[model samples]
Target: MFILKRQDVEISSIQHPKRKQNIPILTYQGQSFRLISVFSDHQQEEAKAFWRELTDHRGKACVLLEETDRFSIWGKVSLEQLRAEESSNSAVSTYTKACILVLQAVYIDVEDLLGGRQAGLFQKDITNLFEKLKFPQADSPKAVKHWLNVDPLSNSSVPAWEEHHLITLLQELYRLGKEYFGNTNFAQGVRDILQDMPANDQNQFIDWLNQSALGQLWQ
Candidate 1:
């Protein structure tokens, strides 16, 4: 069931949603597995299943966890508990690893679309993507839920992916774009979009993310 967290204090869960429940998520480059199946109860078994689904032919995976003390040596912990400890906690550390996985996937996709990896175009898109990743969000999910409750653009009608969740997605797209576009004028494209949009629209920083060069890379 793609368990995001479990721990001694409390188990915080973030299910992938009903639609994605049956989908076979690609954990890494070559290994693919169906989340519809059950995860083993034993920690070693659980770790093995996760490894088989994520590791490539060369036995490498994008996700990494160096701080092993966060859990009861079982590697079971939730995102919520991790965030509660402190600003710099194991939860953030784990999420950072997940983010890297997302980045690698998207970057490869962009490269496929653009043609071949060109240094010039890649640098521009990479720079733009990095800037968009800097937007700050509330630490608590409650704040985000409150915001989405009021705003139309933030509605749950669309599969609501947390902004923090997109870090990996954006990183992947940036990598893919570089591999495909072979170094073109990505930044200028973003600038042009900003220039054409209304001043009020300019106030919405995420609009840059929603409808510009950065957005395109994200797609």
Candidate 2:
């Protein structure tokens, strides 16, 4: 089982001063994670160095992102590099991107529930990243509805905006698992994380997974 433990560390205690923002010190099982984010070359270099430090222990590493930070040039360049590295047999990079997508989805859902300002920005960044990853396009209202498992005739009966965002999140999960982890282990990894989530989130994600095209994989 995968376990996530989040710890609060002082700024003065941060080993890398230059890459300080949004840095969450998360641990899976007993392995410490090196969470990195990039908004420029300097941050990108820091991320690369962090990756190197993992060496044979890279499986414990992942990415940390904020909704506002994902749209920057630094974010784009950093993700592009990570995606490229994924294709080159870097398991750590692949898992980092996958984990980021899941976290981004959860962030969007929380923001929408609370009527937060950054929901739109999160949605846009999620869409852009999915496109860059070559996942199926949820470009049209109809496409979004399909992915969300909403009945076409009930479109007017549902909250379209929330449904659309949920679909985007589900599709990212499905595609990431399918494209990178052969649609099996990654689904299990997601299930492991879901088990640790709040009851509300667990129910929501479980419902979506059961309704999605990738439902059988999860089963």
Q: Largest lDDT belongs to which candidate?
A: 2
Candidate 2 residues 10-59, lDDT tens each?
11122233222222233333434333222222344433443333332333
TM-score of each: 0.27, 0.27
Compared with the true structure, what per-residue lDDT tens digits does model 1 show for residues 52-151?
4434332432232212322111222333533443543333333333333333333434455544554335434544434333223323344333322332
Q: Name the 10 consecutive residues with the lowest summed lDDT in model 2.
A: 68-77
Decoy 1 TM-score against native = 0.27
